[model samples]
Target: MARKKSPTLTEAELRLMEVLWQRGEATVAEVVEALPKRLALAYSTVLTTMRILEQKGYVRHTEEGRAYVYHPLIDRNQARRSAVQYVVSRFFNNSPELLMLNILENEAIDADELERLKAMIKNAQEDGSEQL
Candidate 1:
């Protein structure tokens, strides 16, 4: 049976997409080259993954000479937002607050980072009050 296409990018797909997002466009060889030596992804593996990304509508390709130059259809920020929404829906009962709370509780946040988060929350509350 055929596997269902995931709405969100897989880890492998995200790795390739990060390369595309950084470079703007690249051929399969370029992507393989850009990846860290630790990953050790083969040219064929990168090519196949790029094709999967195309099928998932996250990337498009143009034929340039003998190579197919692939470009990201979505930007990094858009992908991040989609990933966060997916996590919220799948693991937090669709509540972004729950997701935020989990991160605050489980992660070791620095004091400066915690202050920034509190400031952002304060700004959000002010914005909400202004809306009313």
Candidate 2:
């Protein structure tokens, strides 16, 4: 059987998700207030976007008084991993090594940051060896 495709969030959806992920649960008003000032979104817009998110299974809402209190159904880390996987598959030919190489080549990494990365790679290699 074919696996169901994961939903990819738009920038707007991600903004709302960020609020939910931070707050754990929020009403439409709360979400709007928590949103970054630059977004300047209207209440109706936030409500509609949240409803769309609910439909997409990224969020779930419970009726609270006169408002719906929304919470993320997907954890932030889970969504981040899925987004990274999608990018790796689409833009890096499904190669995480290529993705890392691209980032290391393009980004400005100071000596300290390079050492941290090397340590992380070494730890990962050790963990992989232990698993084997």
Model 1: residues with Cα > 4 Å off, grouped in runs = none
Scored by lDDT, model 1 comes in at 0.95
lDDT per residue as tens, model 1, 63-124: 99999999999998999899889999999999999999999899999999999999999999
Residue 30 lDDT (model 1): 94
lDDT of 2 by residue, 1-132 (tens): 985644678889999999998899999999999988898999999999998899889999999899899989999888889889989999999999999999999999899999999999999999999999
Candidate 2 regions exceeding 4 Å error are 1-6
Our model 2 lands, by Cα RMSD against the true structure, at: 4.1
TM values, all candidates: 0.89, 0.87
Candidates' lDDT values, in order?
Answer: 0.95, 0.92
Global Cα lDDT for candidate 2? 0.92
Q: 20 in model 1: Cα distance from truth in Å?
A: 1.0
